[model samples]
Target: MDVFPLPLARIGIIGGGQLGRMMAKAAKRLGCTCVVLDPTPGSPASQVAGHQILGDYHDPSKLRELAEICDVITFDIEDIDTETLAQLEQEGHRFHPSPRVLALIQDKLTQKQAFAAAGIPTAPFVELSEPSPEAFAAFGYPLVQKARRGGYDGRGVSIVKTPEDYDAHLPVPSLLERFVPAAKELAVVVARARDGECRCYPVVEMCFRSGENVLDLLLAPANIPSSVAEAAVDLAVRTVEMLDGVGIFGVELFLTETGELLVNEVAPRTHNSGHHTIEANVTDQFEQHLRAVVGLPLGVTDQLSPAAMINLLGAPGRRGRPIIKGMAEALAIPGVCLHLYGKATSAPFRKMGHVTVLDPDIETAKRKAERVRDLIEISAEDHP
Candidate 1:
């Protein structure tokens, strides 16, 4: 393990989900330890972290306690008490990406506005102060409605194809964005150090699960033309530079049929899109994030191989302790790496884990990934 020769050794993580779990694992490899703050006992991250502080992430007292216990703090999820974090930062507590960035990103409308203000290319959008049917009708149809806060993994977003779909619109303060007819959805994970050093991973293509809006599959070094891919990397790097954040960010984007690229959203921490880097890159995103936050020099992000990754979602209509099926068979495939988050329960479409397939050729890796995907099933032991 590579020990940091600095005072910021003990890391505090908020929102102990799978992201936190993976981050903790990376920290261990770097000769560092993590303290996770989460309300659930034995949460995925808590299962591997050095210690767990059982408390809600939103509680100001719990947030303060976490800051007091560790040298520096970061978060796995975006839904956090930024007000408290800002105050703590004022008092000399270190929080990467800054509480200011988190506060702006917590609201979807503000994020879009910031992108526009920065001259970043994105689909035209407008805030809906009152998301009533009448208001939605005025905005026109075939638009996307996203809640201002507290949305993740396909929740808190609605696609309205017609006036009839307004019944399903998100009722909270939201934004209406003209849905760009995308030729391909892509993502680029960028890491920025406090000293203004920045690096971008190869632009990767993302395939989302229909109706859920969750990432279904990811292909590294996206199969687009070389020029397109370069443009994407440049755009993503510029977007992160604009934020001036000191950590990893996942910038989701849209590629229109006419070959136009537009920014969709930006995630300020380690993100699902970068999960494939664990086995495919010279430096994984988790370790890179730790490096950026702890004042270490960023590592190289060279792709070791073309890779394909798929999320392992829980079986539909199941709810109970998780019972993984077909693991033995799936592991039989060469170049397949399976990761099961120590989640105790299974629910419809819940992310249980992910599988990554690395191969010299991207197409071959994708084929093997599909085979492994079909061979495994995550079901609930106590449910039908």
Candidate 2:
């Protein structure tokens, strides 16, 4: 299908975080205007958006106002109440990826069920009334208990390694899943248009911090066998098709020691793992998402270089404002690009920003990314 040119439309984004900021920037590049609805005045997206609507996500009046002003509505965060989106849809407002998709993916239990219903393979899981002894016994030891909703970036997730740990944090309803002994973690970013056209970026291998779910490094065009990479991309494509997605979809996977693949989770937006595409791919994930959501034909997902992305998290004891040190030294490295989210405050383990390093070889990019990560520091006193 040919690209549908909607006349100079204004898009309304629900969250004003860094993702929204980047998405808005991409929209601007495509000759569209963005109006961000966020409670905070100085949000990252608001900083770049032409208009800002200050209101809560659940406020119908605010949503109606946004619907009236914008031609299409989308979201940066999935935590918003889907009921409100559904209500807006009833009034002829357009929402990309639709409210039904958001409702299915917002809760871990619901997401898992949807995956199963779609015939997608995922780790075995059981919905528990509470993370109690009985729940642990049912799922077995060394399981992961995840909150049904509102979890991201290593929060609302816990590993129940033993009975004692399970007993310690009981009485909360959670989803218990058998923990796969993953040899490596991989992720694929897939983009789909409203007309069913889709494309998937090269698979990325993710390295996590020890004993934590936080990603430390992401290497694109994963250093794996061709079959494994193909399988990962296939899974991502099938998952997005099942969701009837109309924008970027991130599929996180676990590659087991026996070379089996299991779906870990999915994010219905441009993801952190795909951030390297901004500097390394012909068409970045942010731009592809805009194209998909706005009924434009999806862009090519070809890689321009072997890239590595290292997340710059706020260090321990860092508070107040952030001071990035050695940025000059880091930028001195060839093919290194630093991107810091314009956040004013820093807290331990908070995702301040990321740096993407591109090179002819993956190993060289990885080493350069590590050096760049070491050079950047977040001090408490330096305000944005």
Per-model TM-score on C-alpha atoms: 0.97, 0.96
lDDT of 2 at 334: 97
Please write out the lDDT profile of model 2 over residues 270-309, one tens digit for every residue: 8988999998998999889988877777889899999999
Model 1 Cα lDDT, one tens digit per residue, 233-296: 8999988888889999999999999999999999999999999999999999999999999888
C-alpha lDDT (0 to 100) for residue 210 of candidate 2: 68
Q: What pairs collide in candidate 1? A: none
What are the C-alpha RMSDs, in order, of all predicted structures? 1.9, 2.0
- The prediction achieving the highest lDDT against the true structure is 1
Any idea how many clashes model 2 has?
0
